[model samples]
Target: MIHPRGIKSLFLLMLLFPGFASAQKDWQDFMKQFPDHLDISLLIQDETGEPLFQQHAGKRIPSASIIKIPILISLMEKVDEEHMHLDSLYTLQASDKVGGAGELQHLPEGSRITFRYLAEEMIRISDNTATNILIRTIEMDYIQHWLREYGYEDTQLNRIMMDFKAIEEGRQNYTSPQEINDILIKLWNGAWLNENSRAEIMHWLKGCADNSTIPSQLPAGTVVAHKTGTLDYVRGDAGIILGDKPLILSVFVEKFDSMEEAESAIGQIALKAFRDFGR
Candidate 1:
């Protein structure tokens, strides 16, 4: 039996020691269970954008489709600047189609697609053809400028998806878990876009088709506005967890034996974060 004053002291002691110790153990042990070749970058920031837990968060890795997040941001910024309108239509020719994740290639040639519709498919389904269409429609310099201005110095899109020539040239898109989370935090805080644009972007993100990663282990009906980028065995999922406490998480898994395993690992990480942060 302990006195009430002693109970209060015990609680403080737990907070000062066991809390940090447990979190550290959880992260380290989880990572150690997997081989080191599996390059994984994870970051969890509280609603205030303060770091709660980070592992290899700064390491630059393959951006995969996650690079589209910044691309989408720049597109939205262009819209806000009145340089482009979401409703503006662009004709997609046979030459514009790329082989990869999206369904756009199956569409009829000369299919007119609105910028907003392209952006929607770009995010919601990780559509490669739609992404390439936007990349072709939006200037490369414009996207790079926006990323630099946004402080995503390490994140850039160097080529359209499935650009084998660019691949031969060793030019590829790249981004990190840290950068994506920063952008997500900004989007969550409404830092960059106007109300209407932000609202629409969030709607598209929530409609994202991939749920095997961060959102998989979360409770059903949990609203996570996230996008998933996968390149072979590497996977990235960055999003805002819109639950009781509102958290931000970015998990990048690379060089895994299989995407299935990588996604399972990420789902576990997200579950731990949910347990820690969700009220």
Candidate 2:
């Protein structure tokens, strides 16, 4: 005979997953309304681990700067281990500069910035230069270690952003919709941090100003802590929706005619999930 708790849990899973197809008809219907021009993948889950809804979740695609989420988590681990400090200052050099999404590239060489500034700018503005600073400080392999430990087998950060040489060498960053959502779940579950540091991570995510995707179509007052990634033909966002029945949403769009179309699709998907999940 099944244990009482196990039976109850099994019942909950049945209730959520078995009926998900029928219950998420609107989401399916919404997708039908869009043109057949994009590879759209979505995954949403309630506070529990139930698969609220998923489509093409296991498919891997370019992550753009969204890979920074894992990078951030790895950095936090180092912070907790006392190997890094929020107040520690990192000096900027000419080599650290990159050309996408940040004020750091324009800042003069010989500038000094702290971990707090770099991390915040990295998330808030999707700052590529700040990401390089973090990548150089902690190393790309260090972040990959965290991804493996966290069970994200298909997610990879093989090269830094806008790296043409790396691209020429066949290096790229990739992640699945399911894996991205899983990372958010780990963060939500407080996988490896104490209260203060976890809260700080959330704070930085909440500070993100590029709300072009998941948070775009949510209710005006809705609070979402998410990271967005954009490339010429790809757009992605992943994070949590907080306050009253929190939900996690990750949407990835690739091979689109225009960035605007992809961003609109993600916003619509996020709105559907927010409504379907009863948030």
Candidate 3:
């Protein structure tokens, strides 16, 4: 007859070798399959808003256009308070054009555009000209005050669209991945803006023009509301991961030698984080 101790030993071995071993193997395989030089910062939390994994979470990096999140929020707050109407008209002047990934720069001077369209272009397309007009209309100080009021201690809008002065003064722009994730979580939970405004903001986020990072790795039907910021050697993506479970994730990479390599590294890190914590 078989000894009970032998059976117990085999059971214990199975218990020790399965799930943990599989997890380690999966992580290792991911790391080996994709190798590139980049600074990766990620934060993922569970459906209950508990943190699941974090890497380089506290580091600050140039936000690029991702700083537009607070700008969007601040603008929505004004709409929520009825201080500004979405349909309110703003004239686009020659000085308002900043010349980036947008068509607004090509429009004639003194052309009129509604706030709703400007907000859409700003968030959905990262239109630098539209962002500049909104910033000039709303003012940076007010945006900063809104950030402080919303408990975003680490978030800041230090400049207007393509402002060379601010960039030269060592205050170009910056945000931590953690703070971006925090903002996303609050927005997802309907706490960042009013319920109607929150829904509207998320709707705009869904229309983000850039999708070369996290969205590129996700399945066809996966819903990710994200904003992407790109400079020569820096790429950042921040948004909500909506799946069987909803979580906020922000991955920022900086000082990459090549944009393509940096993007590939960010994609690999995003895929790993999504598979691990996205359920």
Candidate 4:
């Protein structure tokens, strides 16, 4: 049975589509194919912000690398506002390396990199080292204030990437499926960002190296600008799927014993959304 919290969103979907009942049944059955212990949160919207589907979308979860999307936005906002320049260079320090998805950690200390390079690598490779560099450069306080000012109260960057000490202290980055979808909506509509910044953001996202989640089961070469996140039992993917009927899909899965199972679910969900909504 679907969680009670999802009923409101399902009702909204039913109101928006004439054949939603049949689609709902299909999704219900599809969800049953996953292990019962697995938890999923999803939000699917059309390019115009119409809610196509939602399931526990408000449930905040460990964002893992998905937090980088907001960091990217925040950085771009600063760049556009003239508070920072993308061409500015930062030197890597021995203290900056973090043990996670990235090659920058292995680079020798004193390596200099541009803000643009760090931003791109942070998304393209899910580079934790690069992410930390950008986060430090942007300053945690300003990022937090920006999120709050922009109405992303539930989405937050509470700790830098790979910070075990902060995690032990009960601090971790987090975002909800709905919040992610909202962010993607802005990107889709070209809101806030200047032309060059928007182009650069989409370019980096389209180049995301990890296609093992939402893009795995998509049609070969389907254009999806997305981000994937992983942390122990938690897994997620959120981005724009450009095609006949463009879509913004954000999914988070947790409490699963197998990473492959969680990721496969993510892929299957995206594929189903593509086919179902494309019709």
Maximum-TM-score candidate: 4
Cα error, candidate 1, residue 35 (Å): 3.9
lDDT of model 4 at residue 230?
A: 92
Candidate 2 per-residue lDDT, tens place, 1-279, comes to: 222443355467667676744666756777888788788887777766566667787778888888988888888889999999989998899998989799999999999999989999999999999998898788888888878877787789999877989978988898887788878877888988877788999999998999888888988988998899887867899889884788888888887888888989988888877787745
Q: What's every prediction's RMSD, in angstroms?
A: 6.8, 4.1, 8.5, 2.5
Instruction: Work out the TM-score per prediction.
Output: 0.90, 0.92, 0.86, 0.94
Model 3 ranges with Cα > 4 A deviation: 1-36
Residues 108-201 of candidate 4: C-alpha lDDT, one tens digit per residue: 9999889989998999999999999889989999899988988896789999998899999999899998888888889778988998899999
Candidate 1 structure, TM-score to reference: 0.90
Question: What Cα-based lDDT does every candidate model obtain?
Answer: 0.83, 0.83, 0.77, 0.88
Error of 1 at 68 (Å): 0.7
Residue 7 displacement (Å), model 1: 32
Q: For residues 69-169, could you state the per-residue lDDT of candidate 1 as single tens digits?
A: 88888888889989999999898899988888889999999898899999999998999999988887788888888888867866888998998899779
Q: For model 3, which pairs clash?
A: none
| All candidates in order of lDDT, best leading | 4, 2, 1, 3
Worst 10 residues of 3 by lDDT: 1-10
* Candidate 3 residue-wise lDDT, 228-249, digit = tens: 8887656988888787777677
In angstroms, the error of model 1 at 29 is 2.7
